[model samples]
Target: MSSFFSRLKQGLSRSRDSLAQLVPGGSVDALSEEEWLDIEDGLIMADCGGELSGSLVQQARKRRGSSIEALKTSMLSMIPDAKEINTSENGPFVLLVVGVNGTGKTTTIGKLATMFGQQGKSVLVGAGDTFRAAAVDQLAVWVERAGADMVRQHDGADPASVAFDTVQRGVARNYDVVIVDTAGRVQTDRGLMDELAKVRRVISKAFPGAPHEVWQVVDGGTGQNAVVQVEKFREVAGTTGLIVTKLDGSGKGGIVLQLSHTYGLPIRYVGVGETLEDLMPFNAEAFITSLLPEHAVKS
Candidate 1:
């Protein structure tokens, strides 16, 4: 646990720095109205979003004890949903992942496969980002690292077809889990989103009740724009959860809480670096402590 906490703090150092610029010393005592306003804006800048930031301020104003602790409880209370992967009812639990390029979609999949593989689950990966030959190669590398098999097609092959083939293979082999990766679809474009819809449809056609989870990956560095991306992807893919990446590279890790607070959807995982093990489950306590060290548990 301490090792994970150390990683969490190291991963969130950039965001902590960004937040420190707002509160300076991380103090919450006798703040002037102007200082309070700066704090609120600072949180929004950290990608906490305006609504959640305002709510935090309101709660802090009335707290009888530590303002930072009160803020922690307030944020924790907003996590109304936390999803756990369960494979009891199905032979191969399917996970469909979508995101823009460079959001670390492939890495996220690889990390998940590694984690599941460590649990002794047989995993199969579908390289559905067929437009880019490099995407398949990248996925192939991670698949190898995770000790999982991959189903891939030549570049320019239909992504939906790859999804279908992967599921069929997983079913035949009775694999524990099958994860599919799709091409990066620009959320604002109708045609691109429509293509994603088609991929989802084909997955359903191949196996009903498959693709049990559709997770949208977002680059947390993009801040509030990540929120818009999630909203759009959810509309197209019925995104069941989120995987936020690039936290170590961006000062916007707070977007996790903002998304959880706004959509109440589960944040399944987050990536802090390029390594397969850099991706970790979203621990609410660790996240809050990393961002607001004043609230961290005393040794």
Candidate 2:
């Protein structure tokens, strides 16, 4: 296995162990009703939503294969295929990132800027999280480390204005990419969500059809709560994709399946560790292999 895959498997070990106990080496035809029920329960306990777990178990039981192989196929079919972030044919490619507080939204932006820079693309970041000076300061450190440019305003300034300025600068300066970071908000707060909507609108106003992608960064350890966050963010922010972070040693990795199966949104990336290299582009096969036990029943 590649080093990144090794890290992914280790990060998801806790979640895998939760399901492994219920799916020992066995033929699917040999599983008793109680054993099948246990497997479904195991999926639920791993944080796959209850309904999805039942559906996966039903599919697995009806499919002809080793118990583990059937489960893997069922899960792989549920998640939508990963989609690449859009790039503009002309002008800067813009990305708007959103998430609840403490979900590592800022850090994900930093890693993305680095990824783009490594591709020899010029990057500009907008520190639109102006509610906290410390937030901009945190982002500044990462921007400098990535050798990217940034735009920010005084604390309490309108976040939408900051985003507009960033896009305007990116356009006029001929930068290759622009990434805008918004203040973290609780999904239940209507006022804050409205501000987030305004930010998106302002970016489009600055450059027509800009903010090409709205990606939400979610904490992998949040379990079912991550589901609710994604639903709310999609409603107000037009979240097009997901970046799941903090999966290193998090038992709640099963939330990835639940989110994908429920919303059919592509999971763009997963953060398996703290390094710049840990923000891995999402791979369906690697994710499933890391999540499920090997097919132990001999052919």
Candidate 3:
């Protein structure tokens, strides 16, 4: 747990700096205008957004015990418990991975492959993003590294076809899980997003309820724009979970707050570093505690 906290703290230095000043050290009898303004500014600077930061500050002002612990509790309240990621007894759990290109979607899939493979689950990967030859090749490399079997086709093949084939293969081979990778289409591209819908429908052609989870991989560095991405994808692809990547490279970790506040989706995992091991399961409490100052941890 200490090692996890250390890595989380290191990855979220930016948010920690802002949050360290956000919470008052001890209980306060009354809220000063300057203090309230400073608290709001710190949360906003951390990228938690104006609405959440303001409401959180307002909550603090209303509480007699607005101590650092109180603030930590308030901050952690925004994130809910994530649903368990596992193979259902009925069939293999299928995860459909979607996002714009460069959001680390494929890398996340690879990490997931490794994570599941290490759990001793036989994993199968479907390279459904056939629009880009590079995309298929990159996913192939990752699946290989994860020691998972891959089902892909030549560049420009119908992505829906690949999804069907992968799910079929997983069932036939009795694999524990199947991860299908989709093209990195901009959310506004109706044609591409609609194509994703087709992939989902076609996936059912193999087996109903096969793609049990739809996960969107968002770039944590994208900040507020990530909200827009989630909104659009949720409407189009019916996103069930999120994998936020590149937190180690960006200070805007507060986007997690906004994401949970608005969408209420389970954040399955987060990528803090480039290695496969760097991708860790999302734990909301640990994340909030990690973003607090060292003094707060000791307390």
Q: Which ten residues in a row have the lowest lDDT in candidate 1?
A: 290-299
Using alpha carbons, what is the TM-score of model 3? Answer: 0.93
Estimated TM-score per prediction? 0.93, 0.96, 0.93
Over the stretch 1-299, how does candidate 1's per-residue lDDT look in tens digits? 88778887899998887776675333356556777677688788888989999998777766655546666777777776685764437678989999998888877888888898999999999999999888789889888988999999888998888999998899889999999999988889898899899889988877788779998899988887888998888888999888888899988878988988888788888888777667888888788888874532211
**Candidates 2 and 3 compared by lDDT, better number:** 2
Tens-digit per-residue lDDT, 1-299, candidate 2: 49979988887888787777776567889888888888888788888889999999999989987888899999998998866678898899999999988999898999999999999999999999898788899999999999999998888999999999999999999999999999998999999999999999999999999889999999999898899999999999998999999987567777888998898899999988888988998998899899887644232
lDDT of 3 by residue, 126-172 (tens): 99989888878887898888889999998899999999999999888
Off by over 4 Å in 2: 295-299
Q: What are the RMSD figures for all models against the true structure?
A: 2.9, 1.9, 2.4
Please list all clashing residue pairs in model 1, or write none if there are none. none
Predicted model with the maximum TM-score: 2
Which runs in model 3 stand beyond 4 Å of their true positions? 21-24, 64-66, 295-299
- Cα RMSD (Å) between model 3 and the true structure? 2.4
Best by lDDT: 2
The lowest-lDDT stretch of 10 consecutive residues in candidate 2 is 290-299
lDDT of each: 0.83, 0.89, 0.82
